[model samples]
Target chain A: MARIDLDHIRHSYLRNPVKDSDFALKEVHQSFDDGAAYALLGPSGCGKTSLLNIISGLLQPSRGRLLFDGEDVTALSPEQRNIAQVFQFPVIYDTMTVYDNSAFPLRNRGFSEVDVDRRVRETLEMIDLGDRANRKARGLTADQKQKISLGRGLVRSDVNAILFDEPLTVIDPHMKWVLRSQLKQLHKRFGYTMVYVTHDQTEALTFADTVVVMYEGEIVQIGTPSELFERPSHTFVGYFIGSPGMNLLPVELDGASARLGSRVIALPGAMKSAGAAKTELGIRPEYVRLGREGLPVAIRAVEDIGRHKIVRATLEGRELAAIVPEHGEIPAEPRVTFDPKGINIYADSWRQELVA
Target chain B: MERTRNNKARFLVLPVLLLVAFSAIIPLMTVVNYSVQDTFGNNVFFWAGLDWFDELLHSPRFWQALARNLVFSGIILAIEVPLGILIALNMPKAGWGVPACLVLMALPLLIPWNVVGMIWQVFGRVDIGLLGKTLSLLGIDYNYVQDPVDARITIIVMDVWHWTSLVVLLCYAGLVSIPDAYYRAAKIDGASRWSVFRYIQLPKMHRVLLIAVLLRFMDSFMIYTEPFVVTGGGPGNETTFLSIDLVKMAVGQFDLGPAAAMSLVYFLIVMLLSWVFYTVMTNYGRES
Candidate 1:
């Protein structure tokens, strides 16, 4: 129930780190407002876990101040911070009964037995484990154990935030969907400031109100899911966030037009002084229109993914994917055209703002 | 679906069958045969039919030895299990200290049992041994040769020294296999140090601790070498455990019938107790 501010946080595992690449988390200066749901999304080894740990105080950053509701908590331990974290693997007390497992946090905090029992019963009911209150946690299934792990946090009434580190990795596919929606419902019900870390785009997009995309130890872009889909600030976000991710074609910019080999595509607005090398035009496969009247292209493969077809084609010696409807016609002399609104101009792998 | 009853694959077990027969079954059956008969030397044998078993059971000396064996095992377990867990808990979890600690802990287990006994035997002598001389100098009556209490204590200490490393090693194996996430989660739960050990660590160590307890129990109950070498069942037969007394009857007194009867009873006792321990511990470790 507090806004967490990770102020200029950077961490390196080495005792004495020298170079910038030595850091696991490069400067992370972000704030999660009170009661906001955020997902730190990135590939493996991208410092998503490091940032999450910094928020939870499990890891003390090598250089930065962490604040909870404007109070400096950088020096505080996780216990002192009163944060709850669910790890990738379920961490349950196997010797305890389901009731005691959920009641562990409150018991540790010296809550009265009656209070603990009442709170634990409520939590067990919430997690659908009410009947298993007296049963030992020994033989529960993976999803059930993970629910206990989640219930450990909800038993407490004073935790600042609940941090999840890929908590659904070991769960079955159907259980994953169930637990995910359960987490969303919990977030809405409790209004706890939750920060979820995952590499799955669907999990990130659906679970969090704000998705912070990271790449190579830095925050590449932080935006709403649709905003990220439409306007990717970094090329990594453009490539990493979508399923047949955004296609990047090397282009030369002239006035408001981008020339890929010989053909030119008009831009929505003129690029200002975005003088840079290695310029590419980024476009989503969903917006790339393939018809009989635009630039000539050789179609390589068409994948029917039930609802939509992904048309993989080579344009100007570069491969690109265009999404077509399931029953859409593929013209014999197929040519491709970019939807004017979907065109994003990048310089040095960073999107440039157009001078409107 | 019907399972094919192929008798051809049944013969494949013959080598193991012959190996067990030659190694264990023959000796065991011979002892059983001798227990049911009287031997008057020169291969002269007569049907005894449980007479030896009845006499051995009625003998106070045999009962005393069995009692001594149980007491020794109980003391060893009570002392070693906790002590081994303490040492393993204190051992360094990482860095060069880990290897150094492990090597030092494993040193005692590498020594042969009789060698360990011989070392402690000399080491506890009142006149020249370091421990006994030091105790005598400290105004203590510390002689294993004439004092039954001192002899019993010496053997117990020697066994602890020799085998507590085994318990430590097994418990250490159990402790390290636990993922770091458990500790982290416990910390976030605001668990006290004792709570962490009780809930997280002790439960995780259940499987290996089962092995350590069963091993230490069986080994201590069947203990013969170390005490035999150190105290030699002296001080008025006080330290004479079941195995030592059985060996004395068979090898020293040359009483084959009584020895074989005692051997069968001893083997069954060990087997029954080990089975009980295994079943109880495995059920306790049913979490995973």
Candidate 2:
């Protein structure tokens, strides 16, 4: 196992990248702990794949260095670094059987046939493809092929880390959950350091202990699932993580209160000085209580989402969403109150601390 | 629930049926008709009932031509397929040099076959040809017209130069269609260069390689114009292939019945060999 450390890594597809926008991956300084499972979460074109490629040594960084267990292996190839990568689309040798496909990596590294057979059989069983081991990989369905791809990565006992670039993109919805749980189980059993990259938050939240949320070629936050839900470090994380994500209202802060239009709400702590920057109060919809006396809101639409209802309304002429109980009564005119403990203040898109 | 069958879609195939009839079946039927009958003079015909076929099968000349055709096709395929694959693998994957290399490789295939023969013929003349004069200056006794071995070498070289490009082009098309992920995964798997070629490149190129082999085999087996233009099947029948001998029998000697019988036998051999090649290759694809 290896602890991958990215030391100010930056990359650009262009030959001459003068501006920050020219870089596909901005300067990223992060460390993946040994044997820890992490997910690089982002939207399309946000450089998560680039960072994964860099970590796997498929593409060398245009700037800075990468270290594995403090070795400074920036110039080494993927083979030399001993990395196993599962691509977005399943890649299998069409001429080989499923058994041979799993054994290929071990054989390439000059393992004995008996050892290769034992390891391959165990890996096939782990991926639940033991019964189809003799079948040709070319005739297998997509999910089965992806399982073989995963099996190939797991067959080798000496891999430093296994990098996955949206490996579940082609899997069926039901199989995705099954394979994800299987991967979690594998990680728990083997303690292999795995870095999974994906755009789906549920996949990231479920599969990763720490999710690295990225936006516009830079990481926005690196935190646990509950941390991301409770306190998103950047505006993009607030907008990206939850299902009707956290709502932010532009507000004026004075002492221990925030004012929006004619309504004033109490803050948990006092603001120092409302500097000449964009200020907003962020709160999750789950924390918003629909009651009789607070800031008045015009209810636009109410959606029944099985467990709870998402109430879309206009507060101070800005769109806001509140989660209410499914059996909660709705007055003709609803007034919403923010839970003081859940209020987070932001200045210029960065989360700020309030002084008590 | 069972759905009703649509019988009206059968008429949509009428055009294709008529086109195949005019293009393939009619010509093939004419050959069959000529193979089974004998003609003396002025449209007077007699049913030979395999008499010409028996005569041609017993003739040693027919067997010799058939052997020569097989040897030539075998040699061409043996030389072209591996050389073409090597050249395609070494080709630049991307850059300004890609189009340049592709255009250069395609130059030989663009030339007319007989014109290529004429060019080689002139180039090999002792008096005025650069190659012949240069070889003479090097003290090598290389005369294609008088020597049987030299004539065979010259024809084989000409065939290689004229047709290796087709194999290269087909293999190159197959090579480029493979996605980059395969290479990346191969690298991560620590695969050797030979392993990558054996597992990834060769399997992907199998379909195109089959096409290349089939085209080369059929064309070289019935080859006529190039060797005809260069050597004219001369030097005591040293370079006389099946097509050249067929012309000699039908046109020079006016032996139509034996020539038609020989032609049918040649077509059958080609069809049988091609079917064998196709079945072996596709079965390999499936069983793997």
Candidate 3:
């Protein structure tokens, strides 16, 4: 395993890339430590795949240095970089047996016949495809073919990292879970540096040690899953990471007190003085207390999702969602209160760190 | 109700059946009548009863022409399929170059078959033609009009130049249909370029390759116009394929009974070979 570093990586398809808008990936400077599972997570067209391709050496950055184990590998091809990739769809040799498809790279590199067969068999067992070893790949189901594609990547042990570009999109949901668990376990056992790119939050959150949330060709935040959920560094992260994400209410701040519409709520510290302080308060739905006291709200709807109820309401012209226990009764007149410590203040879509 | 619906469907197909029978039955009956009977002008006929079929089957000319047809078709298919694939692989996948390349390839296919023959005939002559003149200037003796080897080379090269574009177009269509995600996956697998082509591109191109082989085989096997125009089955019948030999018997000799028998044999051979080609290819496709 090697520590992969991206230093000020920016790319543009045009020959003369002049400005920021011309770049597909804008100024991404980050390092993935050795043996760490990192996910580049974002919506489509947000440059997550571009960053992944850059790290894999499939694409060259217009300006940047890519370091693998402190050695500059920016100009290397994918072959020279020694990275493995699993694509979105299965790409197996249909005329060959599943064993040959999985053993192709090893055979191409002129490995001994015994070593190739041993590695191919081990990978087949890892993917639970041992029984289908001799079957022609053309006759297998789509999911089985995809497992062979995955095994082809995993069969090669001498690689800097294995990159996945939404490899589970074609898989059935049940198989997706099974394969994801298998991948996580395999990573644990092998400890290979893995970089996965996906637009699915659940997959990114479940798979990676560090989740890099991206928006509009820029990396917005990089943190653990819990840190992203509780303290989203950007407004897009607050809106993207959770179902019925965080609520942001426009507020006026005056040192230890924040005014939301006509109601005043206490804060923990003095607000930073900046020109035109357009502050907003962010709070997760799980922390919002609904009771018979506090600010009155008009309940719009309630969704019962087996174990929990999501109460959708309007508080002083701002829509909010609050999660409560399914058995909890809604008061005749509902009032919501925010947890002071849980509330995050933002100015211009950036979080404002509080001084203790 | 279901029975009535089935009856209605059968009724709808009646006119098509009538049209097919009208086109096929009359000519087939004429050929059969000619094959079985002896005629001596003046619209007088006598029952010969399989005499012509037996004589035609025993003829050495018929067997030799059949052999020549098979060899020509084999050479054409072998050359065209691989060359087409190589050119198509090198073609640009997108942008203005794609349409430009497509138009250039389609130009040869659009030209009339007889015109292709005439063009090559004039283009390959020793006196005024560029190829023949260049060869003579280089002190090499190349006369397709007189030598069987030269005639065969000219015919094979002409066929390759004219019909290889079809295979390239078919293979290109197959290549363009593949999604980019598959390439991305191969890249991630750390697969070499050869593996990517062998595993991804070649397998995906199987259907088109089948079509290319079948089309080229049938067309090359039945070829008469181009070689007839260029070589005219000359240089001592070296390039007289089955079609040319049948036409010679039917039209040149005016021996209707033997010619009719030969035509039937020719038709059967083409149909049988085409059926074999189609069945084998589709069965292989299914098995895979």
The C-alpha RMSD in Å for every predicted model, in order, reads 1.8, 2.5, 2.6
Q: Which pairs clash in the backbone of model 3?
A: A84-B188, A85-B188, A85-B189, A87-B185
TM-score order of candidates, top first: 1, 2, 3
The DockQ of each candidate is 0.69, 0.74, 0.50
Off by over 4 Å in 3: B1-6, B40-43, B181-194, B282-288
Could you say which candidate leads in lDDT? 1
| lDDT (10s digit) by residue, model 2, range A50-74 | 9999998999899999999999999
In candidate 1, residue A21 scores what lDDT? 90
Ordered by DockQ, highest first, the candidates read: 2, 1, 3
lDDT by residue (B73-172, candidate 2, tens digit) is: 9999999899889999988999998999999999999999899999989988788889888998899998889888888888898999988889999999
**Pairs that clash in candidate 2:** none
Report the error of model 2 at residue B54, Å.
Answer: 1.2
Better of 1 and 2 by lDDT: 1
- Tens digits of per-residue lDDT, candidate 3, A149-228, equal 77887787777898888889989999888888888998899998999999999999999999999999999999999999
lDDT of 2 at A151: 85
Worst 10 residues of 2 chain B by lDDT: B279-288
For model 1, residues A85-151, the per-residue Cα lDDT tens digits are: 9999999998889898998999888899999989999999888899998888877899999999888
- The better candidate by TM-score, 1 or 3, is 1
